[model samples]
Target: MSKWMMIILIRNREFSKDMNGLVLFCISVFVFITCNCDEEETLEGANTCIIEEKYFVSKKVVELWPMRTKSHVFCWKVPPRCTKYYIKMVPFEVEKKFPEFRNVNGCCDGYKKVGDKCEPECLKRCVNGKCTGPGECKCNLGYSGTSCDEVCAVGKWGIDCKEDCECNNAACDPISGVCKCPPGRIGKNCEIKCPRGKYGEGCLNDCLCKNEARCHPESGQCICRAGYTGTICDTPCQFGHYGEQCALECHCSNGLGCDPVSGACACPPGFTGLYCEKRCEPGRYGEHCKKFCNCHNNATCNNVNGLCICPSGYIGEKCEQICPGWSYGDNCLQTCDCNGSYCNHITGKCNCPKYWIGEKCDQKVCPDGYYGPDCNQLCHCEQTNHEANKETSVAVASSFCHKHKHKQTRSVEIKILTKEERLIFQYVKDGDYKTLANKCAQGVNMNIADINDNYQTPLHLAAKKGCVFTLLTLLGCGVNINAEDSDGNTPLHIAVADNQSHICTSLLYNEANPFIYNKSMKNAYQLAMDSEDNGIKYIFQTNRLQWYQKIRKLKKDEKKLFLYVRKGYYGSVGDLCMKGVNVLVANVEDKENTAFHFAALYAQNIVPMVFTLLNCGGDINARNVEGNTPLHFAVMVGHVDATSILLQYGANPFIENNDGMTAHNLALESSDPSLRAIFNEPLLSWYLN
Candidate 1:
């Protein structure tokens, strides 16, 4: 302030004087500005008043103005190395007058002057930042440095680089705070979860589960659905089982299997149930039990096949029609042609008339002077011709007439031969073949028999007497070769009892039966065996050997047949017969037992085997050495069913064994009421003629 005031006063005085005074003042100021201001103070003539310039300028500049005044034209150019400067002026006269500014008159390096003060310049620039003091800088957003030259560190950003980042372990932009998420994760800052159907880092992995299944979020593993298994839920439940985890079982019946997944049974025809466990009920049948039975007459239907079970006298698939042909009853299984007579519609059995008897009503009532079911009862009808001894002949005739009159009706006629007319039978009985032939030539009935009290015929007498010639003559005359006496002794039986080998041979040649038993229950063979004559015994033995050979030959053809029969092969019995194995082989005995005994003893189901054997001509009444018929064996063994079969097949229950026991008696001994009832059933054929 004092320097400017003194300069203003001097300028006013100089301008008042003229232009010459102003010029002199300006020249003095220029000299002052040109001098170095930073030199140590040197007094140039204290009274002379010398002035030195003092100012602040860059070190890069060589010269500068000492002071700055508005009216003072002090011209100075900036140097190439220095950008700016500042100046200060001091008057020597003024300083002498006011000694306060004596030491403040110099310039300094790296400083710039602004009027009277000095300022320092920064050494380096501040990038992305601002300067705070000399050579110091603060960084802006995303940068940090003394000069704002460095960037923000990881997980740090923003102005001053002071803001902290939360990127969830992901990389983020320091300035913007954006995050880069890992796999299976998503959203800003990587915080939100991945959406469904996606998994694994960034939710990139796709689920592979099948049947609308789900997968693990972290592992991406498929979760299988119910009723399915395997990693992908592709496998179905196994057979006979179903439902989740395949733990449920099917309940199908009749071999029906179930659907694996649904557990529903695949039922066959005529079956129904969850597992087909139930059959169609009553009138219903077939698949799902939906079909209705078409049967009539209250017939039932097959549960599985829907087939009708026809009742008696009915046939056809629905049992709606009558049986065809000779078939009559129950699914057309019964035949009316079983016997010669018309069969019962319900039972398929021949119904014989009162007088006609036999299974088929084939036997006439009281034929051949006999009256019984088997025509075994002798009639009292007298023979019109006779050759009995005179003593007994009249008595025999009288006895016959009296018996006939009592037993017969008056409409029945009787003819009797005179005593003189019955000489042929006497001649034959006495072995007079010539006289017997002459009587035969004389129109006498040679076949006529004189009945003794024993009912013996002429053939019986001739055989008993061992008359070979008369026996041949009687046979030629058509005499009964096997006529039985009252004791049921046939001509063969008489010959065997009398030990007549030739007559027995003749009788055998004429087809006399050796197996027929008399009232004594003895056959000709048995009688022959009891004889004392060696020749007769030899003859019987030879005949037995021949029969045995024939049976053995037949048995050889069917050796394996019994094995089949024993195993319940009923068809094999028929096969053996068809193959020419004699059906009579069933009657051949081993150890005195026929095949019927073995069948009754060992067969599993005796009915089929017994029936087959019977059909093959097995003797149901045949006796073993123990005198046990098939019925007796059946009863002793307590086989009720076999006993029934024997009874149905006409086994003789009335015949007593050597032990004096009939089949009924044996059945009673077994204490089996059922067996006893079978033996006691009404035997109509056994009773009626």
Candidate 2:
């Protein structure tokens, strides 16, 4: 056979050695593998341990084994596994003493390292630099690595697979020996994160849903809200505000409060009650029906308006304010002796006297319409206007123009006028008494003087006022309404002179000529037109008045209404009085007289609804009895609403007293502004004012 064929044929037989010898070799390998896998003493029953120490001494080995003799053992003998076995030993009988058989520097050379001359049966643990499988195997519980060179990972508290493997109740794998964590368990040694859909120790607990439901992944169940129905309680109940839990029901009526969280049923502004089913009580309203108000002083309570009606003396909606115009003290129970217009009958807001509050009473907001303290008086125009038109009732025209030109600077004079050429000069030069001017216009009359000063009469003054009434009055007396003045300007000219629109309406409604013009070639209607002042333009372009009734009222009716009111003609208040005619518009003054204000000065009780309007919205800081609030007036007069309303809207009862007394102090003070004395504190002051 060839050498390769011969090697193959002997290989199997070589592996199959002597029966006993093969068995022994297999047993050694088995022991070695087992020792390498485990080594702790605590696992002694089944654990393995490998031994690498020399148990037999050289001489003892030789003496013990005398079976083999005269055979030389040739082997490589660095240490352990690299030795060959041969038979050689000294016979025990050859020794001198039978006890000396164990002692000797000799040994039976059975095994020898391969390629070496000789090797003893006993050898070191390793050959060359290699220790085949020497030393104890495993590291201690806290230690690990190659040949026990490394420590174990944290929290692992264990020895080998045979020892205490401290894995948290999780069964470790058989092969790899790592923790095979159950469902939901994770981490190295199964000590970390839980599974995706499971939670709670070993994922034992399931989730629940009530009415309204939402699913939770970890627990594989539902979260529920009120009035719902479903496996997860995710469905809401029919027409009910809830989920499967069925916890909540709708809580509301027509319109009322709503649940803060669920946004169930919201309430309206004023009404508050269970389900919002009820309206507010007579005087009680708002949330829970808590806030209450009453009228005090002379104020009258308005149920519908929830306000206190201030009487004349009590000038506030609550009637808690003193009369505005001039009255003060005790709900305006007292009035200052110095008078013109009086305090408001509701709020005690001050109403300064005419020529005091300026034009429109809104002059404070007027750009140039008014000036000075209290914003009283119209802006005066240039004197040149007066001088230029001197001979033609110039002073009146100039004064009118000056006052009207509050907003802008517009020159209307034909030529620059000198002060020397003023109205006085014309008056002085002509000195014509009741004499028709050089040009007798259609409305002029040449007659002797018999009327008022200058033979001009009140009509002349009215003419000076540049109103339609003046010309009409002259016309009624057969004096031409179109009469020309010494400056050759007619009544029509005077009426449109300053572009006073109201004059155009008045004159046109009467008999003043609309076509009449001056040397400037501008007619009355043209003069009425405005390029700047929109208000003036509207007056010129729009309707003059509401109707004939209004016009007549503006003229003849003012007197009638006044007479009726003064005479106390009992009727609808409107039927008997007018704002400027009989009574001023609420708190406004009329001709500097305040009868309505005086009437409120003597009240017994007050209303509330009216009081708040006058107090908060109206002016209530008027002074009658040394500047007292309407509270003083109502207290003196016993008006209930006045007091309640004032307090509700934040009226200050501790306000300073005009003469060192407050409204409360004034109650302690004297009865009237003129008659009251002064005191230091409110109580003392109350006795004085």
Candidate 3:
């Protein structure tokens, strides 16, 4: 044997030392046959042997074949009866020669040779199949395709699709074999439906239905309860309705309504109760009777508006104020003459002064022998002299009788009268015109110089007492109406100070001097200003203005000029100016407005009148107490004609008055464009300069 065969035999002997001698001899015989055989014949036999061995060995065994060159060759030829037994007892050396035997010199006809071994060329990986030869594959059961890469069928999955699917009502994933559950169904096989209150895919969504209402299983939308609506069944019923389905109408009365959610009545203003049917209580008002009234003094507030209905003598929102002044009764409609006494504000009843009685406290003498304001003073005259002096006393008492007169007569004794007592007893206290006339006619104790304890004459006493008839009688008797009392108060002053309107009128009618200042430096008119009586002040003011107008008569020329100017008689205005009326004499009336100022203020023929005054030396720049010059009055009255004439005659446009307003400043504020333009011109500055 060759060196290779010798080495092979030696290696075999060491490995097969435990084998029987017969088995060893058989193996030696196989090696000798394989090594010495014809090259073609041996190769052909090896090829045939590899083909037959490949039927038993798996493809994994083919792939695991060694690639290295083999130094020895081992072949087996089994007897027919020992085929199955000999295959199981195959020697390790023979098992190792399977790939070389199959390839037979290089590679088998259908196998490709790689390095030292042959393998089938499978384009696809042999999954679930075997490679038969070069570029060929034998697929396993339930597998398909040349390389067994394809799964079994459309509905099959897993290794070779061998395992059957149990996807009961659901479709399976072709790739993973996982079941695909439908809506409202869950579980691996989709065999179960979603449980109650559970919905959506895989039963993952929870229902939001309310009040025992059901929801759509797939959408989870709520079926609302009877009294509720909205997608989540969360909204309450609509207005004016409540309860299930909002079908019940609210039964609230008095234009009220009920809460939709809670079914509670919503009361209207001035109405309260479960159904808003009752009006608000006496002291309660406003919506739902929630507000307490603030009405005072037994007053009630309007249930709807909460405005207080005030009782008699009360006013204001809470009826807290009493009627003002001498007003009384409901709405303060009644008037009373309390005569400086406190009166009932609600009843108009005067709280009479001492020795006084009657509704207005006007009664002077009390009933019977009383003689004071409260009727408390008693007469001290003795009864023995009553008969002797009855006639004389009656005459004296009759003189004092007047309107608002005492009807009852007192039987009082009369004493012989002094000159002062004659005036005082007859006129000052309760004097009457008839008694005074009789006294004066008989020339018995009648004295105009008689004064009372206050240094007041009968006229002062009459005026102070508001005795209109006595005052006239005193004036008729030629008594001094302006005689000053101890306090420097003349009868006119006393009349005004006492708020005696009728007495003031009588004194003024009798030519009483209102302008005479007393020791206090206050004339009748000035004293009247301090009086609270509107009527007395009016009388004094009216007479005083008349006196001033009479005393401060305009000159004949000035009067004619002013009258003509005031009446738009321009020709007469020129004539009076020609008569040399002293226009520059500041002859302002009670208002301190000069003829020029009046002409500029009131004249229709403003230009001519203003010219007439200016030519007669009327001061154009002269200002009244109100700081109004003729030009200022011209601007104020929109007298463009007078303003132009005054400006042309060198009137000072820049001269400011006590109010710090120049004619130019007033012109800028006036309504006339000509006045504004004239003052705005540079010529005004030239005239001012």
Candidate 4:
């Protein structure tokens, strides 16, 4: 058996004629060998003549076959018989010149010669390694497998991944086996955790936790402290809850809540104890009892404000002084009932004269039946019918006087105001008409008085203070128009005395009795006349004329409507309007002004009155005697509410009064900014312009 070599050649026209003969002879040899061989059977120890492969063709073959067709040519290493025949057939001289005709050696396609023997080869290169054999690779360190394409698996390193990685919680260098600590780990073996407030790879990231919270070493996740919960631990626990993540419930009592962080109870004013369950101890008041009490003489101290409550036989805020002038008991409200001046202020016991006896010392030696200082003994005595009747009549008269004295003292004494009365007086004194009106609407007695304050009723107080709105509110509440005070003075008298001309006018308009005399035997009109001030007197005169005119000009229904409107009696006004009373008719008493005109004059019930009049088809711009519209009168009086209502209902502010002044002109002349502000509204701005 013999291994044989195959060679291929082709003819080219570019070759000279002498070379062409050699090409033709080689071609004839190639065809002869192929024709002599069996088509399908293998020849033992014999190579096929057709060696057409797509690899490594010699450069010389390409040069010789330049411009040759794409079809392949074949050559074979013929057997000895064929070679002998071919040598005999070809010229000996040509065979001697072409030495390649003897033998040619080469690997098949996709192979290169290394030494003597040809081996199988790979055409494409291997990555991370060298090609050592056919489709085989020799990989470098840290790489393995057929093509050396795979890196070492985790915890492995070195050639073919033969060495194990010596690292903890880290990545290992594939070739060096050096430890690479992951986020939040350090040290040579990656066994150490990152320092506090540091996280992430190499501990380079700062922790985002707040409020003394901790963060995860690796993930930077926040761990909140007690009483805090949030992504960054910035939020405090909600109310009624405390402790870590707000998971704990609070058990505090009588307080808003416990401290959000420590769950400690926080007490309010006048309270103490762990859970604020106790009030301030006696004589110690206010927050935590930090303040000292100023009370004296066995007075009770208030727990909240440290106010002193005076006991019996005591007077003054701190009970520092004893009741004087035969007065005793709580707040010195009790009087000594005794025949003698001397008495125990604490017990109200009379120090009877030598012959006098009994609690009040009314008995002269116990009269006929009773005896002893207390008159607790009984004694027999003879008496006639006339004597008995006389004694009985005398006793009855004494009893009556005693009861009358008590009643009179009680009526005039300074009284502690009730809660409702206190509030009512405060409202009246402050001239808070809105609150007072609300209280009146809630069924409060509008005529209530503080006897401590001269028994002045709300009306008297309002008149004295010259609170027009308050006075109007009281008047409209159906209080006694002429209620007498302790001084026997009426509200009219008070108003006249105080020189409140407007209040006097209001009182007179409400039919307050000007003729009724006070304790000084002076009537309201006389009081006004007595005053040095003429304004009050003028108000009275003018009010009286108006009253007379109002009575004469208005029909019964018109009178009722006018009175209702003046008194802010909207219900009555509504009733009258429903009865078809002419709301447009002008009243002579009100300067020939319509009901709407009076509404502008008086601010009380002005809103409802204006609405009522307008709803009844009253002419909103009706001109009074002075050519002054309702808008004109409203601005003239500087009535903000009235003016605003008129303007809102589309009152023509451009209408000229008799003085050639529009409502806007009147507002500009007035000192009230509210009136000008109403005129300057965007909706009314155009009218003024």
Candidate 5:
């Protein structure tokens, strides 16, 4: 038999070995040969072993008993018994257990290796998504499908598109289940409407409605309130129309309209009641009967302007003056039928003289010593003096009586006198004109005062008693006309206190000191100012006007000031007033119209003139001959600024002119609405103050 040797190539590696090394080596050789043999065959007995590398077809790796312990096996074509020949081992590099290696044949940039394929790789982990390219992700935000591209149908979403959406009257996102609200709605589920005064989408727009109007939330359209019309409810209803879209027509009378909001009729001047259908009642007149009538003598009052409609045989603004001359009856339109005699202004009855008697004063007088309506009663002239002389005198009738000397007897009776002041005061109080005359002729002091009666003289007594003849007798007797009583009141003061206009006139004409201040610190004119008697006020007003006129004559600057005021020259008037011109001066040619009156009548707006005159002591209420004041003239000429200025300075609007028209009355009659509006303003008291 031939012997052969075999060589095996093995990698150098670190492994465990047992004490029975040959056993492991024999087991390793047996498994290696068994794995390397591709075919089974039986070779016969005597064969020669040869080292033929041609039979070493290829190298194959064979693992040993321990892991990573590898060896190279070569298949040889030797004899079947060649397995028992040489076991030569060749050393090679050892294989490492874990090693770092460059990925030369691995997946590119953003890809990873998995098993045997190059799969896509993403830097961020895909959630509900898939990696479609290198570092690329395809997300399924609210969707689920094979490709993660299909949206969840209707109300389903989630991992497998199984969750339902929750939304009300709005759109909902399938992935998140969040709702989207529409216009005029808000809330998480879009279930609430917008609040008041807010409109449009998301309730973000503000409504433009005015005057407490309403608006639609979605469309933002305004709904107007009652008494208002127009877009945004800004305009008021037109005149004669009122209430709820201005659909109702006004039913007011007297050519007036109703309130735009309430539909209530607004009454005009001199009218009142619900629909302004009634006239003002008696004793009330002017502008819904707001003003009281100032008429006297039972006269009819004008409802519109508070003017007095005078009755028969009466004249003047308040119907306070009786008709003059021979006229009588209504409006003094009828002439008296009495022939050449004093006719009664009220009744046309003739007042016959001493000897004549008839309806027309055509009949002769009654016989002497007998006096009656028809000359039938007996006359006793001596008996009238009996009661007057009994207590005051001791009559010596036998001594003064003689048939041839009757005139001397009469003179002796007239010469009877008394020094008693009480008796003389009694005569004046009783209107005993003849007794007072006799006392004056007898040299009894007419100025004597009774001690119990404020030390007042007979002149004061006559004035207090309103005895015109007694006052005249005292004046003729040359009694002290300006004599003051114990209270320092003159006869004129007493007359004014008693509201005796005629007595005041007589005392004033007789040179009584009307300007004298009494113990009450009031003069006659000042006292007259407190009286409601127009006659007494007129007397004092006239007297003061005349007195001021006399003072104006003494001053040279007055005429120039008057001329300046009349010509509406405020600059010249101011200069003149500064130079001590008398502002109280009246124009006699113009029936006592003052400088203030002319300025008010002529100027367009003389506010400076008003201040100048008022500052210089001009009378704002001073009346001219026609009873018109500065306010009257100012209103008559339509001077608004002048009127406002005068009102601010306390000008009285209720003072009437000759026609019984007040400033308010004139305003009611005015055509200019702005001028009329001045009186109707709610700030009228503010303007006055």
Candidate 6:
């Protein structure tokens, strides 16, 4: 509508004119309003929003990032001119609860579906345990199975240990990684079983032992047996018999004894002896001939009584010896000359005396290089060729009797077998000929002429060969390890001479008698010591380890505790101590100490100490128990510090007993830090005074 017309109509106030102007104005206003509404709708329909693009990285693939297209639900209004824009929303494992957005722009580049002519960058992935793209997946270690679809099996837990559990002896529960124990049992692996006569978590009950009997902890039973009774079956019958079977009895009275358990008479009432031999009289033995005889002569005719009698050669109350050499001879008739008695009364046989030569004459002779029936066996050794180790002529000398080393000839079958090659040595088997190397003089029965002692045993031959394996094999076959060679040297000695450590090792491994010294007085260890090669010595050293290994299994408790160090520390684990632990030291310097004294003196505490001694149950107050306590030691070192602790534990500060010194005296005498500190202790001032 025209402003002028509207104003003029209003000024004139003419009703007809004003109505006409109003209708015209209304038509114009209607057209303008319709046009503006159309424009606003067109602007809104522009259809471009500030595109928000989020890209998530895959944990599985890691390289590719998947994009999510979502626009901001609430955004800052845009200017009328603004049409298109971009906002990059980086997809992260931890998503943004709220993101800032604004109306802006557009873009043609968006993540297109796969197999569509898309680029490699479009393929999404899992980033940080999350899917960045459409088809991304990642599984942890145990879930390695396809798609991490499967998990550990029954009784299985831990990485790949599907069924290995700590229950049922490390049997894992199927669903949860828990353990299961056997029936009538519980705990980690169900290792502990219920004891007999009692059943429960720990077999803790008064009914454990049976019928008023006390049970052994391990055996879990009352000690009642066939002939025994009582809770632990520890007592015996007062009358005599007492044992498991009551097979004994006290027949130890009236010269008799009973079975230790049965109360049966082991010996008759009057008999007294282990086997109950004879009757025991008043003068009898101890408890039964259990009394002793004072007789010197070996002949004692009295039973029950231990009194002895003077036999033929003796005559005295105690029958100590021959009666003053008067000899009770000739039926005590007389003393005879010629050193002999007349003879038997009926036969008249001459009784020759000691050191006599002639038969009835009883003449004497000189000793040593003498000859005759009167101690006359003399230097029959040929004066000719007195030299030893001499070769002799076999022909005429055959008849000649050279007292020493003369050959005795005998017609015997002689056959020589082929020389045999063995792992040990080459042996020449000569048939049926016994050769005596060294012989004694005047050989009669003096020499074992028919002695069948032949080639030494296999052990001897093995020693000769110095073949350790052969030696070991021979020993394994029960060959005497100590068997001597012809030279009288044992394999042990031979092993030394040859310096055969390999053979020695083998021999020692099979218990080659390393300690047995030969006639030469040399043992294997000594031989090893003598050798130029250290290998032999090394073998000896290692042999000790093998020996200890064998015996280690045999011993237990404190004795088996093997203390070692550094390079030579044998069979030791960093933490494990089968045999306890101890330290080898110079004179066990102190009862409660380690070898750390030297190290500590050098101030090498930073050496990263690994206590090989471990907490080997070493005594802290061991000396305290003995009165020369650690407190005393602390004082001795001039360090009274440990004294307080020692005294607190009931260690007597004034206990100047075993070593003759109190902690105060020791502290007063020395200059160790701890002891010095102890001397100044006010509480100990009284003890010091």
Q: What TM-score does each of the candidates earn?
A: 0.38, 0.20, 0.24, 0.35, 0.29, 0.18
Candidate 6 worst ten-residue window by lDDT: 28-37
| Model 6 spans with C-alpha error above 4 angstroms | 1-425, 428-456, 468-477, 485-488, 548-689
Candidate 4's C-alpha runs over 4 A off are 1-168, 172-222, 230-235, 269-272, 279-497, 500-689
Provide the overall lDDT of each model, using Cα atoms, as 2-decimal numbers.
Answer: 0.61, 0.38, 0.60, 0.66, 0.65, 0.40
Q: Report the lDDT tens digits of candidate 4 across residue range 388-438.
A: 233333322122211101111212223558886788778888879999888
Which of candidates 2 and 3 is the stronger one according to lDDT?
3
Candidate 5 per-residue lDDT, tens place, 249-368, comes to 999875556888889986644679999899899887655578788888999876655657788878876889887765777877665655445567778777666666566665545444
CA shift of 408, model 5, Å: 45
lDDT by residue (1-689, candidate 3, tens digit) is 21223223323332233322323223332222123222332332222224432212211111111122224333453432321111112333342231323333444565555544556666667887898766677776556667787766745655556655566745666446777776777788778878878889888988887666667666777766566777777777754677656667888874334766556776545677888789899987666567677888999875544557789988875889998765778877665555445578898788776645667665553344433333344544433323223223321221221113221111111244465466555555775767877655543332243433556566776877887877776566546566666677788887777788887887787788775656544567656766788887777656654543422447776666566667866545544543455554435354456777777777455544554465455677765545567888777778776787777776777666667887888888877677678776576767646
lDDT rank, highest first?
4, 5, 1, 3, 6, 2
Q: Where does candidate 4 clash, by residue pair?
A: 49-76, 227-243
Against the true structure, candidate 2 reaches a TM-score of: 0.20
CA lDDT of 670 in candidate 5? 89
Candidate 5 is scored at a TM of: 0.29
Instruction: Give the lowest summed-lDDT range of ten residues in model 5.
Output: 403-412
Off by over 4 Å in 5: 1-198, 202-215, 286-294, 315-321, 324-689
lDDT of 2 by residue, 118-142 (tens): 2322234322122223232444444
Q: What ranking of all candidate models by TM-score puts the best one first?
A: 1, 4, 5, 3, 2, 6
lDDT by residue (349-379, candidate 1, tens digit) is 6665544555655444444454443445555
Winner on lDDT between 3 and 5 is 5
lDDT of 2: 0.38
Model 3: runs farther than 4 Å from truth?
A: 1-239, 268-271, 283-310, 315-321, 329-343, 348-689
